[model samples]
Target chain A: MPEPLFLLSPGRSFSSVVSTMIGEHPQCYGLPELKIFSADTIGASWEKESRPGSWPMQGLKRTVAELQFGEQTDKTVDAAEAWIRERFDWSGRQMMDWFQEQVGDRILLDKSPANTENGANLGRIVKAFPRANFLLLLRHPRPRGKSQYSTISKVLDKNGIGGMGFEPDVEWKWTGTNIMARQLGQDLALGQFMHIKGEDLLREMDLYLPQICQWLGIRDDAEAIEAMRHPERSPYATLGPVKAQHGNNGKFLKGPALDFERLATMPEASRDGPLDWDETAEFTPQTRRLAHAFGYR
Target chain B: MTLVETRPAPAALATLPGPDKPVALVRFGDALYVGTAAPDPMGRGRIWRMPWPAGGAAEIVYEGADGSAVTDFAVFESQGTPVLYAATAALGGGLLLASRDGRGFGPVAPAGLGQSGNLWLGPLAIAGGRLVVAAGSAAPLDPEASGARLLASPDPESAVWTALAEPGFGDAENSAIAALLATGAGLVAATANPLRGFQLWQMDPGGGWTRRLTDGAARFSMNPAATALSAGEGELLIGTGAPARPEAEDAAGPAAPEVIALDDGGAWETLVGEPRFSPEGFKVPFALQAAGFGQRETACVTAILTGPGGALTVVVTAVTGATPGPFGQPGLGASRLWRSLDGGESFAEVPAPGPVLAALATPEGGVLAVAGDAGAALHLHALA
Candidate 1:
């Protein structure tokens, strides 16, 4: 069985696209945000929660149906749900190992950002896949943090749900991102963790795409690199079956055609936080230091 | 457990306006005060006070801020006056204390739920001769202050609230204090959101809290929020929801309806196993999976009543949905009534009510079941 490749981050990073792009490799299989590793046991994963607007298991059911049953129908999705219910008491390790074994030699590219939020989550992954490799995907805290702030508040407001105020949201963005930094940087061996920036891959895909392939030691052939660049061609780039309609990121699912124009709108990284969310706020000195450590200016 | 036959569909007692959402129910003096969110979201709330067994002419006792919603209730009788604490859901509503005063309610607790972290304000009880209430952060994303804290107040007069249980104690499995019961063992609390297993926390003599992990969770336990807890024949009967997980469902298959009984002698027994229902004249499993049939989340015991002659009645409501997961619409949230003949050794379903969100024992030797949402009603039934 091929070891899984996990994209670890606090999201709003280009994990979906990057993970999908890597999965586009002929020898690899890209997975949606199954988030199968967030909980210690398979039963625990059902109780796991994330910040608002997090993707649910509709994607996982869809992925399982498409990959295992060879087709997407109401029956297959129902069977997939039943299949999941059947393993209610399995440990997270047992479930992940089963998935890896089922995939056989295909490298499973999983871009589950929540796995990097807590040290306990990372600890579980390390214990589950001793030979697993991690891609520490970083998005500039300034724009990425702002995006998260607006997105979280917008969803809460739209749904009539209550949450922390603007200032706390900014602090949360900083704190969550910092936890990601510490968890991956501190827990893993030097060689096991590879850091990458979303900006580099978006603006300079031709160069960085091949470079990433080389680092992972997958086929560096022209066809393989070209296929890797077209993440939109992946089977999960659009809405899935009726029962499991979402198998990928909402952004990527809508218009997966990769373009660099969105990167132009992002402001330069800043020491000060999104002041609109918090006027009297600045990143903690420790958070700032960690940001710099991630090669952010 | 024997099959208790059907009586009749629970009939409505009174009619209220549409979109009236109930928050909390409390019995103060001879009146049962019901907290309801006004029809208009921005309108002031109305507290309806109904006379016990008489059950006629429910008059409005007090009206609160426009668009305010009540979440929980607490009874505090410290400063010589028995006061009912009504916790408003959102911050703007604040907390209201209802007494037999001129207006019936006044401010008692502050309103700052999402200000610092997730504010937990329930599982109230009288433990260690003090009024105990739970307050903590429930936000899973907020690493700091993201668990439960049991606050103890010596009397209603004292403003100081000391920590009875350490913060983060209920956060072991994203579990927080969900239900509280005053029992012979001690003031007990049940936590929610199961992983390793569910547990019950008990108040000790030293003014501290201890917990007992519930049995039957092999790798992970059900997020059993003890919605209904009753003590009878020196045993505690618990009704809870298993909360079906699409990813990590129980290996025994999806959890069926269940109730657990804890004996006064420190022995815990599973009163109800993987629960099954027989809605007279229909095969429950086939009926539930049929096209028009509705499937709900794991069974949630809503209310348990201890009647005369060592009999116990447990009411369960399964919030059925058109689809699964968090986003599905609850098409048919059904609540059923069950009774145990010999203590709580077993139970039988009595076809009586719809999704009964709440049930209260009436002074007339019967149980008053409040059922449905949107089209809501109050029903009266005799148990045992």
Candidate 2:
């Protein structure tokens, strides 16, 4: 059997763009982060865990909403979510089966950056799908971590999730997730895994996209490359009214970039304090060492 | 710019043994030793030393205490004899074992090396005649008690191990020794204290150890923290990072605290910053090794970078490996090979393969032996 594609990374690491791009390929089908395998059994709670607010659920909701609902209107998003809950009955494998039915006999790409944080979940993934292929998407940690904090601050502000607490210790989360992935990569030989840089993807899309397609055993024809250009055309583009227009035609459909500088400068006690870039301005030698190791030095 | 395409090797390189675990690559004499964590039922890990070219297969060389996995190993020349040290830990805790001729290894506990049931050793490094090991508590220990202790062996043959220094800022529980570098100044150890952040401390023979850098809070978090210490033209270079950390708010924010250089006086400067050095999404650094470059030196760091693309790439960076660059710029290039002629102030790219897991300097000139998922591939480049 062909290995299932698994994207391992922290959130906001360009997972959406890359996954959608891969999904755009004719032979590849991109599914949202179902995160269903994290549970031991499929049930109501499992369905609950697959909701939009929870980490694992968000990706699934988004994927389903985009595939079924097509737009972010309240009616469409609710219908999509309801459709997903009813279809899979919270069984990850069932969902996989459903995906296979939609895409035919091609490899299914299930991407959930949030799953990267939980080593146990990753273990479960490997156990459930022994033939899973892992594509680790890496972004520069500094900017990515900072961006996560900035994003959280905005989310809390808009949704009234109340004041953010301790910034969720993002630095530790980033390291922990990466460490787990590295250890797993070591445990699983190299042929089963591949690492792609997000910066390279954005800056050198043509080069890396083709490279990824080659690794996935997909056709590297011009048609496949052109398919990636219109990611919005994928069935899994919009999740809710908020995300309805987000991904359409293979393009990133998101709101304008916020001024993270202002949020990053908030005082330490403020909800966005930890996100303050200047407050945490010193680079540890350990970080420098990592940068140098990655050829960033 | 022209794209260069290299033909694939005629034959597929030898694949790693089943149950692929992290392997430490070291060079001894004419052979490159590949040490892997063995799946011994007793828990003691075994080291399989294979001959370089024969690639015939793996041969078990050293077995740790009662089947407990060997967490780390280091090779250093003691006097004129070569000694190999392996950190062995089982359910009982951790111990240091030494092998002289690659065979039987016995416990080499030194004086004043406290016996804590919670000790866990991570990475190992050897420089000069001294051996530096990053010792941490497998579990929480006393705050007044030192968890992360720097142990040094004056001579490799002697079983005498002495505590060189302890981190000043926090307990080993909050902080674990990530990496150690024997620089021109002295032996500098990088400690990552989740509560205190990351700090650089220096250890001297007589005066003991002192804090050299303690701005870890200024950076983000230090998770699965790993470090590499190497010497450049005139400075000591140290590299470290967890999977993720807060970056500079600006476009050219501070580099991920991946590499730093310490001067003779024990002062450190940032050699690289965010965007340039930090891996996108999450990337945790694991291994570091340095190779001498004529009179200069270069080092390679191995890490895992996770991007939003939901893929993890094993990244290996080559740096001055010795000196601290000017204006905090250490080196450059995102390729597998990078060179720094003007000390470490600047770096240029040298093309190499993808997802490099480890690199070692060749005994021959201008050649690097790189191993990755693709296969055991070797690339030769001009130092200039």
Candidate 3:
């Protein structure tokens, strides 16, 4: 079986849209934010998701339904939940194998932001699939932090918990995740992993996507590339059944299409300014150094 | 001229050690040779060779002692065989090494031409049936009469180096010769004078020398050194800036690099830089569409290579000081590659692999660049 390609990045780095587009490629099967790697087994993962405020298990349940029943609905989602409970002892690796088997020879792509939150999560990935391909997607920390705060603030506002001294600290998440992904590169073969800035990819997808396909030794012909343009065509692109309404970002699920105009005119914030959440606190020097290393000023 | 906003990715031939700075690249025999300056003891200023037309892992051909660097590489005909000449930059003195084959090398000239001050030799040119070279001081800009020395040798194997011009071209402030080119006019040498600006001097075939552009070609001393020189269709293309390894006082000085053209009739035209009126007549930048080449930062035009079909590739870098950023240090300023197909009328930016230190035209109609961050890894990449 071919090794899966894991799109790894910090939260709010365009991983959802980019991964969905790449998964739309004829040779790959893009998975939602399974968040299954946080624990050793499917049961453990389910238990972890049961905790409040944890990343919901909607993505995992929806993926099980879509891949097993070839369609996602209320009945299929319930069946998917029961299916997971029946296989409590199944390891995450076993779960990935079953999904890969269902997808045939297509390369499985998983981009779980939570996987990078824990070193053991990434280690589990490499140990389970030693030959897996890793794509470390990066975003300029300034925009990443801003977008992350925007998403969190909107949620807090909707929940009537706005401005309750809940400051979102995005610096650690952005830097820590990318640093872990870079360390992951050291464990892989030379050509088995790559690091690409999300901004560059979105700006010149026509120029870089084919290069990426070539890197994966996949078909880069026009038809195959054209298919990748409409990431919304993916079955998981929309909101799932009410039980599993979100396996991805809510905004992305609402309108999961490439916004060329917005991407082209995306506001660029320099890495050297004070934090948006706190006016007095600036980005740590180490964070700025790492950002500079990634070719961001 | 056609411009591709998105440049195609080029193949990486090799990656030198983190402490190595790739300074020179030349095509010899069936392979491309790369020379690196390693300040650390482990690197030893190594030279590497990769198979041409079929690039793979590059093997180290020669390695120098600690604190030495391969400054430049030149190919010249010795009898019927083409000999490779490698210049060394060292503390005590520089050595000119020669080899009939690319692997093994022997000294062709005495270290520093027997002058301890001439610790660096480079910018070799073959003109008037003789091998001409310039020797100067490296970093920490030496002030011990180790200033620029222009030398020529009719019989290089004999190792007899004759001074073509006085030390520092008779100016103590002219610490080094940053660039040399054999043009239709003669052997042209550009000096690195941080004090009085860069000066261009040409030695004619009749053993006569003439100062072509003085006071940085009317741009004043701001243009301190001529960093690169290349032959145009019917003229000489000169790239001016502060030296890569600059003097302490000149490191933080204002520098807006420029590319000037010199015709055979001794006329001058500024290709890129501030448009001004000067002794060179009313000067206007031909590529006014690309003033400063779209770079607002203080930068220097480092290397220029004119290839087949009138394609010209120029490497520009913002002077980030002598010590390039290593793994832990702040990274060096990014380098940009601009190419022109209609002479200097318009230029298109080509994405570079890293901070390009030097560039050379390949035999296969491509541009090979020696790019690296100082004290960081060096990479040899081809620009298509």
TM-score of each: 0.48, 0.42, 0.52
Off by over 4 Å in 1: A1-297, B1-13, B37-46, B63-68, B92-96, B101-103, B112-120, B136-146, B215-219, B243-253, B275-297, B321-332, B373-375
lDDT of 1 by residue, B1-384 (tens): 455443322222244445554435666666666666543345555566666545565666666665454445656775677777665433242343446442367655445322343243554677667776655443111112235555667763445666767664635554555567787678887665443334666777665666653422111243234555677777777666544334212121233445666666555545653211111110112111210111234555667878777776777666443222111112335666667677755455667656665566655444443534554455555655
Q: If you assessed candidate 3 against the hidden native complex, which CAPRI class would it receive? A: incorrect
Candidates 1 and 3: which is better by lDDT? 3
- What's the residue-level lDDT of B280 in candidate 3? 41
Model 3 over residues A1-297: C-alpha lDDT tens digits?
788998888878888899999999999999998887888998888787674664358888889999987789999999998998898788889999999999999999999887787899889888888899888888988878878888889989988999898987788788777767765664455456677778867877776677778777799899888888889999889988888888787778999989888877776578776887667878876576455445455
lDDT of each: 0.58, 0.51, 0.73
Q: Model 3 chain B, poorest ten-residue lDDT window?
A: B323-332
- Show the colliding residue pairs in model 1: A88-B249, B43-B66, B44-B66, B78-B156, B296-B320, B335-B355
Q: What DockQ results do all the predictions give, each relative to the true complex? A: 0.01, 0.02, 0.01
lDDT of 2 by residue, B1-384 (tens): 122232322232234444323335555644445444433334445565655543445556765555355556677777777877777544455667777777566767631234563355545766446776656553111112136666667774566666666443354434566666565566667665544445667756664667766544234332223345555555666555432222321111222334445567654554443211121222111212111111011223443222222211223443322112110112322335444444444443446654343444333322233334333443333333
Model 2's alpha-carbon lDDT is: 0.51
In angstroms, how far off is B60's CA in candidate 1?
3.4
Docking class of 1: incorrect
How does model 3 score by TM-score? Answer: 0.52
Q: Candidate 1, residues A1-297: lDDT per residue as tens digits?
A: 767888877777777788888899988888877766678666567557433454347666777677778766788888887787688687766766666777778888888766776777777888888778777777777777777778777877887774644333554555565455544533454335556667766666666666666656678789998888788888777777676776566777888877656644555576655355566777665455445434354
